[model samples]
Target chain A: MRKFFVLLAGMVLFLASSLTFIYVKGENDSVNDLLSANVDALADNESSGGLDANYHRIDSKCEVFVSAGMQIDIFGIGIITAKADGKIAIDGKVVCQSKGNETCRPVECSDLYSVILHGGER
Target chain B: MRKFPYFSFVLSLVVISCVSQTKNEPNVQGISVDINKQADISEFVSSFDGYVCLETYEECLVNEIRKLKMVGDTIYVADDTKITMFSRRDGSYLGKIHKHGRGPGEYITLTDFDVFDSRLYVLSNVDREIIMYNASGDVLRIINTGEGFSNLSVIDEDNIWLYSSDSNDSMYNFILIGPDADVKAKYDKFSKNQSYTIEDITFCGSVSDTLYVSQYYDNIVYSLHYDGYVPLYRFDMNLRNTVSQEELSATPLSELHKTYKYKESFRSIMHIDRNRHTLFAETWCFLDGLALKTCFVKADMVTGKSHFYICGYDVDERFPLFDLSDVIGYDGKVLISYLTAFSAKKHGKKYKIGNLADISEYDNPVIVFHTLNY
Candidate 1:
């Protein structure tokens, strides 16, 4: 009876240790997955030039659904390209983002006009 | 006799009450339109009357039509720089207004013009002057409107309504000027910076004595009264993309383009016209994701039963895709639009459009006159 009691106590201790190890490992994996997802999202935002708010993308597969020569007029500003090249042109003059800027933002119409007409930033 | 008097008095009181109630009722009707609902263009457009292929020549070639108006058998087609007159009956070239210069009778830019009582009032926005010409193309007089008004509507010989989208004056967007070039009154005092440029051509349109004014960056259409204007109709498009007056005020003028671009917002209301108590507002909406959406919200001024029609997304492929971008004017009788000769020829073959059967791909744009059913 004394030998049986000792074995039972050892088994209980082993089961608790294994359960704690499994719970800790599962939590760590979940945390690592969340971190990886966040990193991937950040990388995508960076690689896309971060103008998701300004520029809209029309998928190439959906291009056939739209009319030919369909233009999105930005209220008389400049026409931002939905193509993958990400080129923005105003009245046939291509205006690029400022140098050394990782992210993109809207270029003012007047600023774009000045750049096109006077060949420099306003 | 005493009973008769009481009855008469009671009748007068009831009449007065009814009149007061009618006056107090809101003139502007709030129309709820679902932009997603696809409607057949044939439901609103009754029949195609005919097509006029504007006679094209080297000397009278219209590079682009900015505004087209018809008056007294003459169709006035104004391009960006010049105005040319063509015969309404046969599309023959009559003459061109080729007085673009800085001289006394000349204008630097022909922004807008109106034909009233055989006189042509041409507004030169850049020059800030209006040169009046008789029917024979003789210069009558030049009125120097102190401000650069981008558009003008001649109410009568005495009153003219002027609108400026490029004014630094934030107090008023419209100025009513008299014959003597004096400021008569001002309307539409928007709080935002009024200097931003918008490319809408028609601001205010008149049918009979009633003139409807479409406010810039606003959804309310107003009827111009003696002192001010009263709201005639409100277009409730239920669009997610809209900028409030506060947002417009808070946003810098330089950043306004960003506030409107690529979003599914009502960019600007163009071609506000009314015929037989039927109001039509050609609303231009930007690209929604991948689809290009343009809608025309037509409402009955009496019953307020509104119809929303989306171009290029009509129910049947047989109907011609009519976008408001090509709409020139909506007369009381017919809604006039034009299609490029290329498009007319192409769509003509596909849809079997009878009016476009005689169209040539190399010819000028075919002017299609549409009669509205609803």
Candidate 2:
């Protein structure tokens, strides 16, 4: 009886561990999918190119590559790729790749991030 | 021992199911407002008579009038950068209260301001301080509210109520501060753990002794009392067609616009006047395409006889002088400001504002005050 009880306890622990692992892995996968989907949506925009003189609208049919220390305002739907050494500014503040260095920071402003994520739907 | 594992698993499943069921249910309960029909402005507003014209060309060059409040004859106006005082009787500039610097008694960004008892309280976003000034534009005393607050309103001479974005586990959305800048109370009557973005849709207004607060996403409007926040009214604009918060969160940020492209969303409660028992709100609904539908709701608190008017007309058809951008309630009157140039050219003959041929596009706005018929 003692041996049977010990076996049951071990099985229960293993099952719980497996369930937790699966749940966590599933959550992580969903998060990655969300982020990748956002990136693809932004890249799908046709108007992506060098900084337009208008300062508001960047008119281009190709991918807009922003180098470090360059400030560009994106209007409508435009995909921007920041170089490893390039930085980008959004809404008057330097956001990504500042000072010739790439720093990863979480975007706090939901409205600003929504504009970037949605490719300027508004 | 063998049955113990099976029993525990069954119990856990029951608990999980109960929790999920409770979460899916609507947590709020209050009066419902169903917008079944639309009415013209004249049908609901009784009359749309203009009381004052604020066209102080250069004296009060309001670059962008963010907020306006009238106390007696002093009209406090918060423009894009600074707060300017003007005479309500005449469109003359009284004085300006812009100490734009990083020094003491100065502010980097003027977020909001309120005038009470001849004292002006200016809340600076960057400085995280409430700079108080007397009627003469002299700095009184600065109250440093250690953290950044999004909105503020003076409850009385000694107490100030402020809204701060809280990501912490705390459920409170507002903090009442004393004269010495000490937190007097923290109160909220809603489900906790709401996203930080909810703050953008939150607005607070006080009329008489009751403090009215509401989140645009939520249908309920809460009034802060001495005890706590009580659900005063609920607006049911038929948001059943809108995207649920659960679905919104599950969807990717990038796909939000596409998935909910045609979904109608409740934007914000623009103005609330308790004395007149009136509330104005702006909602975004897809009409031909995306468009704003302004709702002017009036409810009799005692009788509960409510009526709403939907102001969704072209610039020419609607009251040309009243833009839904900003509405202020003061001294039992509703004040609306319009860009004089736009109104003058759009419906010059219809509205009958004399000779705007010389009014440039850069001129100050024309303030229109309308008396509410109770």
Candidate 3:
């Protein structure tokens, strides 16, 4: 009985460690992918380097509003729509999140705008 | 089924380990502030003076005042398009600068401006240059800095500091440039790519020739030294008010905003100003998606005792100009901000203070000055 209990405990411990590793690794991988994808858009070519992927460079005259379902339209940069069910899409590509996903969360219209436009809440 | 107890125990252990990864360990150094608590208005300002209405004219039409600076008797108000000057005593209209072109000494867009020694230094990010002009708007010199920057401050005759928060997309966040537009020194390079957007031109300010700079997303405020930066103060935020820096860096950029945890968290360090041994830091946080809460932190550099307060929140007596929301310039001695005719009249009546009772809603904005204790 004692021997069987030890073996069972060992199996559980191994499984737990493996699960935790996968969880952390998955998060790091997603972050890495984001950084890598922006390389081309944020390259350091002086002539064309004014483009900033982290900010939605809207003209001061362009009116911005946070309406129902988090809809914001920047004339040149396509439309961004975020739904209360945890779905965010820029030009229908679903860049921020999917419905009921724990990954991305928005509490307000400006938060949605910040996520969609400024890349982060800060 | 009989072994269910053992299995459940193992599962609980796994959950605990995962939770421990994000456990909040209170920061031991610096001063920790509870930003949500109510505070007294007197803590921010020692005294409140009257108001002055800036004279408006066709040539000095301002859509909105983004920044206000004072040099001697002149009050410089900069909007998105141009910089207009007014008398400090009576708000009389002085000369104005409205040059917007691609030609010599012209700026495409007015991003930032500073007044030092009767000279106006305007930062043109789109043109990637600094246009130095006399108080009368005559171009003294133009220095083209090859790269664009968000803010610039004249440190002295030889050193000028240009700062930007877009580190991932830009070469450096802090660059010390010479009068000749040469890069004297560059600092704040990250090992990995990172970027955050901020809209304040007050991120960098000086008191007595010493320069202070703070990144919006960073917790530490640094003073520029000869070689690098020296960390002056660290704001240890309560766990309830902030997301850990590690968590912020780990989250993917696309999913960062969607993180509900970040919705009501500490947003950014908006402005930093120092007065003698006391340093004042104004911070912003999301109250909700639609609103924002401003927090003011006053820290004693010598004793390390800090006072944290929320502005425009519950207070016994509300002071309009004392709020950090409209804070334009603070030079250790005086704090200045602008109040629209509506607000000036409304607050002036409710509080029974200032000369704003007679101002009309159609009139120009009234500038209010406050005397500081710290």
The model with the greatest lDDT is: 1
Clashes in model 3: which pairs?
A104-B258, A105-B258, A105-B259
Residue B328 displacement in candidate 2 (angstroms): 4.5
Give every candidate's TM-score on chain A: 0.42, 0.38, 0.36
**CA lDDT of each prediction against the hidden true structure:** 0.64, 0.55, 0.63
Candidate 1 has what TM-score?
0.67
lDDT of 2 by residue, B211-314 (tens): 87765344456777556766655555654355455654455322444443334554446555665444443332322121234556666665665666554232
lDDT, model 2, position B78: 77
TM-score of each: 0.67, 0.62, 0.66
- Give the alpha carbon lDDT tens digit for every residue of B1-374 in model 1: 76999999999999997887567435657778777675667667777676677887777777667788888778888876678888877788888777888787998778789888868899986677899988667899889886666678888888888876535342567788888888888776756433344455535466665577774456667777447767766787878776664665566433655555545666557667766777777776654542234468887777767788765443244335344125777666577787667667766666677766566677766677778775
Which candidate number would show the highest TM-score if scored against the true structure?
1
For model 2, how does the per-residue alpha-carbon lDDT over A7-67 read when each residue is reduced to its tens digit? Answer: 9999999999999999999999999999988877677643563222211110001112222
Candidate 3: CAPRI quality band: incorrect
